[model samples]
Target: MQEVLDALEAPPIDPEARIALQRYYVRCEMLRKVDKRYSEDGRSRITLLVRTIIESEGNENALVEPVLVAVNSVLRPGWTGKGLAFIEAFDGFPFVTTLETMRGLNLFKEENLGQYLGMVLHNRLLSLLGPPEALSAEKPKRKPARPLRRAA
Candidate 1:
């Protein structure tokens, strides 16, 4: 779903994010296979997602941590927690500290990780093509991302 949307809307896949996303996709499929194999053998849905996430991503600090923080922090419903490393790795792009930037990003969804990723290939596509008025000072103001209080 998000993949098509993001591809149509996004600029281009960041090199690092692209690699991680690919790994995630592969890992997810593999885990699904394992879970299905076990389930057919009469086992429950095994917790293969995490291991797959780690293996495809290399490590939390190397991959998932930063993306998680960015996703959690920027999305409509913000999120937070310790060892949230993806936030650091995804520092590839600035302004991502704000959720609105992500929504504005035009990315697609990809499979893997703690949750599904926005797989859209849209790069921070600057308005290279747009109405002349887009650059006007009269442009409407955008809503700011509100920060949630960290739980004690």
Candidate 2:
């Protein structure tokens, strides 16, 4: 795990993105340490999800990692996290970070890491897209829904 922590130093990524990534790592650790109540056939849910993420690559029938997809959309669009290391894509475009400072960070205490990561990712997307006013201006007006006809 030290190696994973140390890996954060070489390629700088966004602070928020870094936090999300670390939180994910911490989550994986937590899942690893949790009891077997969550296990099925000797494998925990996290293990299954990680397997899916790895095995699903290039196969249309396999389940994709939705969280990874969202992370890529905000950090580096169209990136598949292929060839590059697990966290390398964060160094591109808008996302970039150090984990040393995480020791004192209170936000990590949240119970739901996934929700927290989503919030961070959303904020990063908003920042990159521009201010809220600009976003509102850019949004196209939606046409009103037409009434549906009764089959009878």
Candidate 3:
């Protein structure tokens, strides 16, 4: 977990690749929500979701809605002013660090502080990308051509 956080905090050599990785994370989360069976199979949910989304002819909006919902659900609690402040300071907070450090002490049988941090990061990335649209509604309409007129 420390390794992952350190890597994330480090400055990126390739900004584009970093952005792509962030998007990939969001996509994986979306896919996991769309299909619960992937979690049961112990396969790579991210890879499966990317492949499925790429190959399917279904509307993009259809695919994005569930992903948005999943991401939204996590952020819903943070909508309040106090929750928002906690979220903003989440990474650097002493309480957060204490919780993470305590995980090594084996207080809980199963600790998921790292997972929660990852989710928060994922939510932040998605928020920056703006809302996902499964289906774009900006198609241009074509006007009928006027009848050809003879030269005067």
In candidate 2, what are the lDDT values of residues 24-133, reduced to their tens digit?
55654566568443222212322322332333333222222234334433332222223243233233322112121322465554333434454565565455443223
Query: Which lDDT tens digits does candidate 3 get at residues 109-144?
Result: 333443443465456535643333343345668998
Residue pairs of candidate 2 with colliding backbone atoms: 13-96, 13-97, 14-95, 14-96
lDDT of 1 by residue, 68-125 (tens): 3223222211111212432233334432333334445655233232232322211221
TM-score of each: 0.26, 0.25, 0.23
Error of 2 at 66 (Å): 12
Name the candidate that leads on TM-score. Answer: 1
Best by lDDT: 3
Give the CA lDDT, 0 to 100, for residue 34 in model 1.
72
* lDDT of all predictions: 0.33, 0.37, 0.37
State model 1's lDDT.
0.33
Question: Model 1: runs farther than 4 Å from truth?
Answer: 1-8, 37-65, 68-95, 98-152
Candidate 3 residues lying further than 4 Å off, grouped into runs, are 1-74, 77-92, 109-111, 115-152
lDDT score for residue 61 of model 1? 31
